[model samples]
Target: MIRHCVFIRFRPEVGEAEKAMIFTEIAALKERLPGFLAAHVGANVSPETGMDKGYAEGFIVDFADAKARDTYLDDADHRRTGAKIVAAAEGGVQGVLVYDLEIPD
Candidate 1:
């Protein structure tokens, strides 16, 4: 199994309403695409005592393996959702970080 995580930082100028819309679109991807074991998207809620770089939203996706992950990346539904995210991204901070790891248990 693989756990694919993405960290997204929205543009500072984005508003709450736009953020909600982005979140909704992201949440809807699993239903529209195949090869997804699980999917979730949310805003960062971590308390900033000292080490917060101000990342805004994030997504988590689980797949059977690298093949599934690659397929998901090119799927029509995913492409559509990703396009929406790119269009809505506000500032220079709107970035994505992805990590894939095998399940350890």
Candidate 2:
């Protein structure tokens, strides 16, 4: 399985409702795209200081494998959603971080 993690720091003016809408849109991708196993989205609630690096929200999407992950990256819907995120995020693309990990047997 491949775990695709995304962290975001929204622009200061972005409201909770807008963020929620973004999350919902992202979650909806599971039904539209193949190879999307599951997803989880939420705000960062960590108590540790200076660790979050201004990223206050994030999500994790699980895929069946790297091929599925690659497919997701290339999907037009996913690209559109990503563009929304970048537009809302502080510093544009700089406000987001993505990390993909492959689970071993």
Candidate 3:
């Protein structure tokens, strides 16, 4: 299995409406894309004690293999959703991240 994780830190000027639209678009990907074992989206619940650049929301997507993952990267729905989400980022920093790995089980 491969895990694709994303972290998003919104620009301070971003309002609730934009955030909601972004989240809704991202959540729709699970049903639109194939090879998705699981997809979860949520805001950071971590207590902001001493963290720098406190990110807002994050998501985890599990795929069966690298091929499936690559397909998702090329998927039309995923691309459209990504474009909307990317537009909401601050300075194009976006706080994006990803990890790919196999799981033995």
Candidate 4:
């Protein structure tokens, strides 16, 4: 299994509606792709201050394996959605952090 974790620092002007649309686009991919297990999206709720480095929002996507994860990466819809996220980010792609974790089953 693989966990795709993405953290973002959205531009100040990016509103809730746009954020919701981005997340909605991401959520819809599960219906079309195999082994795209689940997507968890939300804001940073940690009590600690400054730890997030201004990345207040993020999402975690679970995939059955590396193949499934790669499939999602090559999807056109995901490319578009990722473009949107980059656009909404504070410093374009630099405002986002991605970390992938592989889990043994």
Best by lDDT, which number?
Answer: 4
Tens-digit per-residue lDDT, 9-29, candidate 1 = 666676778767766766676
When summed lDDT is taken over every stretch of 10 residues in candidate 3, the lowest stretch is 90-99
Per-residue lDDT of model 4, residues 1-105, tens digit only: 999999999999999999999998998999999999999999999999999999999899999999999999999999999999999999999999999999999
Ten-residue region with minimum lDDT total, candidate 4:
19-28
Per-residue CA lDDT of candidate 3, range 15-64, in tens? 88877776677667768677778878777777875463566676778888
TM-score of 3: 0.78
lDDT (CA) per prediction: 0.71, 0.92, 0.72, 0.97
Quote model 1's TM-score: 0.74
Ranked by lDDT, the better of candidates 1 and 2 is 2
Off by over 4 Å in 1: 48-50, 90-94
- What shift in Å separates residue 95 of candidate 2 from its native position after superposition? 0.4
The segments of candidate 4 whose C-alpha lies over 4 angstroms from its true place after superposition are none
Q: RMSD of model 2, in Å?
A: 0.9
TM-scores of all predicted structures:
0.74, 0.95, 0.78, 0.98
lDDT of 1 at 88: 54
